[model samples]
Target: MVIRGAGRLTAAAVGVAVTVATAVGLVLTPSSAKVEPAMVADPGPPEVTISIALGGATHGYVNPDVALAQGGTLTIANGDGVLHTVTSDALGTSGDPLFGFSVPARTTRSFALPSLAGGAYGFYCVFHPGMRGTLTVIGGPVGEVPAPPSFDQALRIPKVLSGDHITIPMKKADVRIMADGPKTTMWTYGGSYPGPTIERRAGQQTKVTFVHKLPKDAGSMTVHHHGGHQSSADDGQPTKHLIEKGAKRTYTYALRDAGKPAPAAFNFYHDHRMHVTARNNWRGLQGMFLITDPKEKKLGLPTGKYDVPLHFSDRSFTASNQLSDPFGHAAHSGHGGMPGWMTGEHAPPNDATVGQRILVNGQYAPYLTVKPGLYRLRLLNASLFSAYDFALSDGSAFTQVGTGSGLLPAPVTRQDVLLGPAQRADVVVDFRGKAGQDVLLSTIPRSDSTGTGSRNAALMQFRVRGTTSQKARVPGKLRPLAPLKGVPGKVSKTWTFDLSEMHSGGQHGSFWSINGKMFKASRMDHKVRMNSVEKWKLRNTSDMTHYVHLHQEQWHTLSRDGDEPPPWEQGLEDTWRLDPGEEVVVAARFTDFPGVFMLHCHMLDHEDHGMMAQFEIVR
Candidate 1:
């Protein structure tokens, strides 16, 4: 006879009487005789089915705790559209799982539980540690269950690739973006979502080979060294040279600006395929590039593991954990469709794509454990369109030491740092006083004129623990940056950015334009004499925001709407944000290898549509 109880029976109490009666076969005599007639029509062990829940980590299992017979059949139905596993907790002296069953996405699997002394059994998803549950058996000895893991997982830092010659292959990989989410299939570089960090010295020359291994449907590709000053042949012109499937290309970087060592800065590399830049970049072809100099090491700053690079981006996933294509639907469709004026035979490019999920270094809201000390954070806004106003939840201020191009002459204390798409910032954050506290790095939402801003606010968490004896300080003076050698108010060129309608292929459609002209691949919009310093005025007439990024040389902002530039804008910058009806004057010197380079909106969706133009520096 089976007996069930909330508490286990004492061995001492049951051993003397129960053991003697069971050994003599007297315990089951009356019960077995009464059930003998019913045993002939036994219907086998009981069966129960459990479902893996949908949504996020909060909803783990449909029936988390279940009680069943000792040897019942257990079935797991996985309808979450991603692979999952039912793994028992560690048991026995060796600490191995008692039983495990693999269940694919949208499928079911069944297994019979081993007959053992009854107790509570703990189980969890192998892929997602946050998913856990308990199973209770009716009659048996009690088992010890370990506590489940927390929702926060350690942040994953990308491996660094440093060498004279580097070869990176592009392919598809399944990556886990959240601690409690399914694996997502993404096009990756070196089989990683954000690829690998490429580190190089300021004055070193490096040769990089990009091998295309993506599916044929992915089509041609191009890699743009966003802030590198290289020759035209290696500049990754969107329409000129292309890397097809099963093909490879080599790009050589001299790492010099007009025979001078390039400034040490944190930059990025990404896809630049014409008409599909947004699509390819959204799929995961992006990475961080760091340029170092020996002289900068003299400054007292954090190094090695203490210095962290945080890349911020956004993504949306389907129920099956696949990336949602922002441009896959018909332009006129009411749901997630393009603007009404964007109808055409070809797929219409999106105005902007803001995802609900915010990812830091390819993971969702990961936490970084740090010792109590000062840390240097290199922040990059790699998203396709979303801009972030970064701040710490504790309301602590950080020291801003650098901008996109390089270090600033003097450090400035800032309550928050604002970065547009393709922009970067170097800051030093002090966590010595915040030990045993958890601080969140989050974004303060700004008003979006296009109504496509990201809803996600939290970026990551910093769990402060441990002690540190290391002493490092942010120097008041870090580097020297000279002003651009150009007249203050002299405007060499005036470019107007606006949204306008154009007639093409016997149809009228809206397009983002610069200076009232759409992009033409074979056309050169402007020409400048090499080694000439010039000032340009950029005016945004449209209601939406635009991020202007220039290639080849970094520029200094002279004024914003006829007012002095902010402290963050006083340093050398490669990108600037222009609000509605705002005009910014910037000064730049066109030098180095003279060739055709691009100047366009860093909002990739706008650039892919028509907001790009080319300029040539003639010797």
Candidate 2:
């Protein structure tokens, strides 16, 4: 069993009873550690159950954290106050198949591993990066599984916008996508990986119905429409409402009366399933959701074919060409300051999954054939764990036109722009005179890794082709931004992001905290009035990095620490990353959404572990 996400902790003692029992002809020794068997009146199946105690800085295994049973069910119970996942491919080794189960708060869950010829299996929380254990399967033949086919998609994936009212069916379909090799299987939506881009205009009421036609075992899914202010039901908060396999749900994004209309910006829709988000998204369950305004569109910017939405992500592939979790199966990258958690003894304080290869719009080092003119590129750093500092190979300057929120005050010429996970930027690249130049889109080293600029540097290539008659313009002023001073509510809350450790209960791992508390879904961390704007002070107390994200509202940065925010952050934004010990002040207003919303780290693994918290929006 695998548990994901963060929450409270617990402690318990394993029973000392010594009863040697046999189930399905498999010998079992009574464990010195505490554990419970199935509560069925009659022994239903050959199974071994492990009780997990989760609490402050601790994830305790009641048993030896190893097993000798063969071909049976493995049960795990979460006796904690938050959601968790038990992912068997915790080390992400190629020999082990990825299997996960969500152990909800204070609940027990089980999974069957019937064809188990195993040696040692490592399991960990998809959420808690540092919490892991090993389970040894003895008396079974150990062998390797067959490798998957190579995955290489040679075409440039385009961004598509859904119609005004569209019905999107979510089902398990195999898609052929290649990044650098042959075709590989991709779990997809509507038969396409990354699904299909859904585009909408501000003030337009769009109703989208998601039909879950996935296989019975594909697990539940929910599409979180980030950067939209609608309602709690439509917000797609994790662990709240999910579309079970064969089930369906409709979300209405009624921005018709969202109060003076938030800025039109680049948003995205991705799977936010409880406990299995990292795997789900890594398996190709994400897409672009762009919001546009007519006035901004009429500014004669790069439109139509010239306007490109580039989704950048990094991925690791197994020898068989299957998508593998870098967190698991990967060699511990000791780059930057990452805690070599893969092989190290203790959990690293905070770690991010950095991939070995980069993908641009689902293509590996793809070349974009562009005319000698200006093109508007909507850049999204969709990498699950990596942050990037993007620049041209030739070091030419590009103008940043917009941010994740919307249009900037003016275009800022920059030689390089840093993008953290889940962050977006709109850039204007001019290729008029550089027609024959093959410019490489390179990335700088991330905060978590050492300078890998030479290894996985270039993301994509821009092949300047024939000439085009299209003209693009960058206006001096894009739009008017709201003043932070007169925004409504007072300074309502302050959240501190930090690291905590649990040294007792026979458990040890580094965990993330907000205001010194781990994330608890059942607990509402804060509350706010609807339609009232409030200022939030976010302080990063940890010695690592965190990208703070708030759902439903596109807020404005009031200031960073004590000084004013830079031009890039002064617009409508949904996410921001803070360096260690850095403090930032941002303001947001609750509109029609009146329910529980989330404010958490966007470094998905961290959020899954414990760096996430929620607040209530009341009427």
Q: By lDDT, who's the top model here?
A: 1
Q: Over the stretch 495-528, how does candidate 1's per-residue lDDT look in tens digits?
A: 8887776555565666789998878988988898
What C-alpha lDDT, on a 0 to 100 scale, does residue 492 get in candidate 1? 88
Clash count list over all predictions: 3, 27
Worst 10 residues of 2 by lDDT: 20-29
Alpha-carbon shift of residue 428 in model 2 (angstroms): 0.3
Give each model a TM-score: 0.73, 0.71
Per-model lDDT:
0.70, 0.63
Q: Once model 2 is optimally superposed onto the true structure by TM-score, how far is the C-alpha of residue 24 displaced, in angstroms?
A: 44
Off by over 4 Å in 1: 1-151, 330-341, 344-350, 447-456, 486-489, 503-507
Those runs of model 2 whose alpha carbons end farther than 4 Å from true positions after fitting are: 1-155, 179-181, 325-351, 446-456, 484-490
lDDT for 377 in candidate 2 is: 89
